[model samples]
Target: MTLSEELLMAYDRQLRTDAETPSAIGIERLGPLRLVTFAGGRGFVTYQDLAGASARTISHWVAEALAFYRSDPAIARVEWKTRGHDHAPGLHGALLDNGFEPDETESIMIGPAHSLNVQVQLPPGVSLRRVSAERDIRAMSAMQDEVFGVDASDGNADAILRRVAREDGMELWVAEHEGAIVSAGRLEPVPDTDFAGIWGGATRAEWRGQGIYRALTAARARAALALGKTLIHSDSTEYSRPILERYGLRRVSTTTPYRWRR
Candidate 1:
């Protein structure tokens, strides 16, 4: 396999499978569809490739998964993750008809963690560290929500607290300036994989170009290295893509999510 392909497999094997929220969501086989349900009242459907499935079968899979989610009142939303490389026919139309809205088309990036794990110079008065205390986590999550344009979510903070209670390898990192969070991210070490996922990266709008996020990432990379993880992966948005790209991660593929929300 080519280097990029190798990195992609590393990502699937190491990072994606260990998604605490998504991975734990047990998979349900509905014909050709693998319906995934997570703890957060979220459902997801994804397949390696849909080459063998006929259009009718593909539609059937979509309908079945939707029915599965619709039947669950607790399921607030569902995301059908599609890879650009998948050969599933008529996926777009089927999902739209099923009341799924498309999120941004994200680049499926993969590469060496060490490449981006370098020492980034943080702006003056900015500092990075990992936090576990409830107070600090609350502060961090609130800042991230605001930076990323998301509403306040106790789910994320609760997840971290849950992880801390279980002593899970998940760690929350933040960049703080003058007692306020300016940037934040999470490092998740997937079991049975040689990689860790760097997720939930956000920087306050005014804090951009200040090198805080990079420093936060660098801190996470350092933590990953200490954990014996050699690779890192993230589903990046346009805002953080260039920063990660500068660190040597490549855009290997694209991920399109079809969302079904209540």
Candidate 2:
């Protein structure tokens, strides 16, 4: 197998299950699926694979999983995370049949952590730091929400603060310019695994192409390396994919989130 395939295999083996939901408030099992509940009334569905179930069986699992989430009044929305490398049949149609809408597909990126640890020169007056204070975290979250075109609410910041309180080895990094956050990301080190994930990367539109995001990614990668993580992974949008690829991260696969709202 190629190096990218080998890395992808390692990701599937180690990053599924509990590693995928470290901040989960509760989890229940349905066949091979892990039904996860987060702090913000969000339900998530993931699994190693569908266990080679036939199309009919997969459809049944989808209905059952949807019912399981629907029963909980606290769950306002649920996301079924689908990976492109899986062999399950008829999953796209099954999701749509069950009132699930597919979101944008993202590239599954993986590579050596050290490759991203290299220094990238930032624009003048731009600097990177690891944020922990509630105020800083809140600002970073809001900046990300703006960049991603989501509502700037406290749900994500609250969840992140709770995770910080648990001391889960998740680091938040940001690039600040003129006292404002221009780029940000998260580094999560998976316990007992050689991998850490760099997630939630964003850059303000005006700041794009100035190397702020690249520096932020490198900062997160350095933090990962400091924690003994040799491999890094991310599900990257098109905006960030080329930057990661330039740093030696390979596009191993694709992932699309199917959303269901109550």
Candidate 3:
């Protein structure tokens, strides 16, 4: 199958209609999809089998789902993660009609585990390793928030702590050069799936294209494969998109998140 076809099938089988695993907290059923409510009063929608839904069905689902989120006072913001190949008939129109403004459309990059798992030559005075220390985790999360342009969040740190507390098979990796963190990423080995997710990859502004991000990704990929994951996936921005492309990760689809704010 082509990348687009695989994308559609994946979303159908995994995201929209029959997502086997929901987010760790605050998920409610909205028809066939799960409406995810997370710590920051943020709502998310995901499903796996939306490829076959008719235009009218898609229309109704979108309207009803927005209404459900809109009625909830605690939901200060919401994102409907729409995949590029998903047969979400009239979804764009419906979302625009409902005041959900589109955010950046990111590349849905996916590929074999080995392709991105190559060794990286870290600069002298640089080190890479898995981190579990509470202080290190907080600092790393704070750096991520800064890079992503969000305020430093205790909730984010708390969640990392919770993950560490549970020993949830989630690994945080960071690269340090000259006694400071230069790049970092997370490896999430999804339980019972051949896939692992590479998320929250961030690099300091001065360290942008010196193979640090790729090295961080390679480290995560190596770890994932060691744990028997065959596939890797990420929602990539333009910066990292080119790097992943060079590593044989195809842009299987696009995910444009539409956010609704109170």
Candidate 4:
């Protein structure tokens, strides 16, 4: 197999299961789909593959999945996560027919942890550290929401706090300038796997291209290595995909999330 195919297989085998939802409160299966309910009134759908279902079957599954989530009053919104490499014919039309709007596509990046462990020189007066306190987590979450153009909400912070309480080996790293957070990300070491995920990476507009985000990523990579994870993975936006590619991570596939709001 090609290098990209090899990496994609590793990701599919190691991450397409419950490892994808470490903090999920509940999970139900519909065929090959995992219907996951998280703590923030959010629902998510994922699976290893579609099993080559015909378009009609996929449409039926989509409608049924919506009904299942709708049965739960607590589910405020749902996202059906799709991967570009899957044999999911007509999945997009099926999603839209059920009122799901597609979000931006992201690169599924994967590579050796050590490739991202290089030293990076931060801009003057900037510092990096791991944060666990509520106040720090909130600040970091707010900064990320702002960077991503999402409205401010407690859902992300609350979810992070819950994960912190679990002590599940997820570390939050941030870059600071003058005591204010400028860039941040999370490192989650997948149990019984050779992978650690660097997720939710964000940097303030003015702070971009200063190597602070790179430094933050390097810090997470070091932590992942220390925790015995040999691989790093991320679902990266266009902003961060190029940087990760420069550090030797391959874009093995793409993921696009389709959302339904109640």
lDDT (Cα, tens digit) per residue for candidate 2, span 1-262: 9998898889899998699889999999999999999988999999998899999999999999999999999999999999999998999999999999999999999999999988888899999999999999999999999989999999988989999999999999989988999999999999999999999998999999988888889888888999999999999999899999999999999999999999
The parts of candidate 3 lying over 4 Å away from their true place are 2-22, 54-56
Q: Indicate which candidate wins on lDDT.
A: 4
Model 4 worst lDDT window (10 residues):
152-161
Per-model TM-score versus the true fold: 0.91, 0.98, 0.89, 0.99
Q: What does candidate 3's lDDT look like per residue over 19-90, in tens digits? A: 333344667775667787766577888776474778788788888888888888977888888878766778
- Which residue pairs of candidate 2 clash? none
Candidate with the larger lDDT of 3 and 4: 4
**lDDT winner, 2 or 4:** 4
Report lDDT (CA) for all predictions: 0.79, 0.93, 0.81, 0.95
What TM-score would candidate 1 get against the native? 0.91
Q: What is the lDDT of candidate 1?
A: 0.79
Please give the distance, in angstroms, between residue 198's alpha carbon in candidate 3 and its true position after superposition: 0.4
Ranking by lDDT: 4, 2, 3, 1
Candidate ranking (TM-score, best to worst): 4, 2, 1, 3
State residue 91's C-alpha deviation in candidate 1, in Å.
1.1
lDDT of 2 at 99: 99
| Model 4 misplaced regions, further than 4 Å | none
**Candidate 4 per-residue lDDT over residues 205-247, each given as its tens digit:** 9999989888999999999999999999999999999999999
Residue-pair clashes per prediction, in order, are 0, 0, 9, 0
Q: For every candidate structure, what is the RMSD over all alpha carbons to the true structure, in angstroms?
A: 2.1, 0.8, 2.4, 0.7
